[model samples]
Target: MQNFFPAQYSTLSAAALKDYLIKVYQLDPSTTCRLLIRNVSDTYILENQTQKYIFKIYRDAHRKCDEIEAELELLNILKAEGNSVSYPITDVAGKQIQQFNAIEGIRNGVLFSFAEGKVILDLDSAHLTQLGRDIAKLHQTTSSLKLNNPRPVFSFETTLFEPLKDLKPHFSEMIEEYEYLSNIADKVVKKFEEFDTSKFNYGYCHYDFFPKNFHFDEAGKITFFDFDFAGQGYLINDLMSFLNHYFFHQLNNLISREQAEKDFNTFINAYQQVRPLTDDELKAIPYLGITFHIFFLKFFYDNYDDWSNAFLTPRYTKHRVTLIKKWEEMYCNF
Candidate 1:
């Protein structure tokens, strides 16, 4: 079977990918080992006598802005601050980011030195602790690098309720599929609103900090990748989102709430070693967890049809409902 990116980004032709590689790095196209499609991006690998490089072709440039620039800038900032990260490869123009026009639309692209090691989800305490320390270092240093992009336009309240309000005419249909997610989302939003966002510090964060976006070397060191969704946000927001993805959703093992809480504290403690958190930030953690849960719930609900369009699986709908119920049970007890 032939493998290619979805129709939306099929503009990346094989010949074009080959040409881009040869022109950029002077590598022989015959040495092209493989090309793979990742969600909205296409990646190609080329091998010469002694070196290899990964070229990433980005789709949807119209909406992407100069995100590669932001990512490279962020990486440089983190590296200067002593955080390990993948470095972006420069183009013939001596720039990290390059713009190209394809038949489908304008496509922006960049290359990167391949990040090392494997992404381990079921990591041990030592690795998790290292992840925490590394992330803390990143957050601490990135606070000063003024970035060029804005936060993504959507969030828990705006992405969920705003759409529900507009879709009121089809309340029955929406409710049928989501099963009271809107009402639960409202409660989640209310709980978050009651808390002070000011208490939680905001800065550039790897919004999608899943294990897949991380690397664990043999020495137990961690390096992060995919700053596609990176931007300014509450610090704990990304931390909890990482927890939800690794400990909660992805593993689905018998992770006791107590154990999960311990892991969260470990990461937070390591982060605080370099930069301390305020009383308000501590208070905001629990509510922010609930808010992020509802945020993804609405995300799943809106894209209910054609599950492949999303990074989540079809079971994500059920997982979201369960998370909401868990939050409700915990909230009432509190």
Candidate 2:
């Protein structure tokens, strides 16, 4: 493997950021920026008088400018269609995204209108239904939107098939389990190779629609933010990612999976009411959802040698394979 730039996602210091915000964004000199979270990217909350905004400094060398701009374009399209998204705002020079020299290194920066309302961590049926409807609306809105530069596309091969191969050399204690995952990934590829995925079902989608990425208001409106993972891919991919992660949370007792089947139906039916998912896409959901487990398995194994302590034991890895097969069967029959 070749060497590449590692993430330099240190927090933004208030002193170093004042000049840029004042000169470019025309904010008051007394504006205060608070570091919200330094994970993956440095995110800050900027407040001056009654105005509130989000300032994000992208991790150096992690994402390209054009790709970030494409995501920004997606926000504009959704907002123009009255979809209630927190869109990106431009500075005085009409620049939607800016790159500046930071104390760590050169990094990309963009400002956004703060998505209002408090985040609801524990979701009920009503919230889930509205969430489903909201995502379907986004899929419908950006179906035909064009972008000069787009992010990478994902597939069984990209998400699962190739990652296993690349991580083969990294396996230490779980080499056998890694081999089993490789075979499972291969079977997934061969089984689903016959379908045509490009039949108007592919478009730009929020690749990460996990629970915490959206917020709800008292008036029962849903506003989704965080388009860092937005890209062109199968529309169903978004739905599957949501469902798979929801199930993962359930598996760990983070939430109630007792209503898993019923809730799953509600979300899918709500989505279909807005934008009908074809029979083929419906059949493919289980297979597509398996991609997440495969991707994360490789991620946990490669990045952290502590996967054994954190996740299933080697014996349970095979157990997980069995559990996944049974779950897929139930999902396909659902």
Name the top lDDT candidate: 2
TM-score of each: 0.79, 0.84
C-alpha-based local distance difference test score of model 1: 0.65
Which ranges in model 1 have alpha carbons more than 4 Å from their true place?
Answer: 1-7, 14-16, 27-33, 151-172, 176-179, 246-251, 293-319, 327-334
The TM-score of predicted model 2 comes to 0.84
| lDDT of each residue in 1-334, candidate 2, tens digit only | 8654543334557566766776799987778887787655668888878788888878644577888888888899899988988789889999988787655577788888988777775677898789888889889886777788868667667788677777666555767767767766776677676556555387887877776777788887888899887767788888887887566666667766567767777888988889998777877777776676666555555434322244445665566666566556645432
Lowest lDDT block of 10, candidate 2: 303-312
lDDT of each: 0.65, 0.74
Q: Could you tell me how far off, in angstroms, the CA of residue 28 lies in candidate 1 after the best superposition? A: 7.0
What does candidate 1 score on TM?
Answer: 0.79
- 202-312, model 1: which lDDT tens digit per residue? 778776788888889888878787776676667666676676654464246656666766776777787787778886677655555655665555454544442346434
Error of 2 at 291 (Å): 1.5
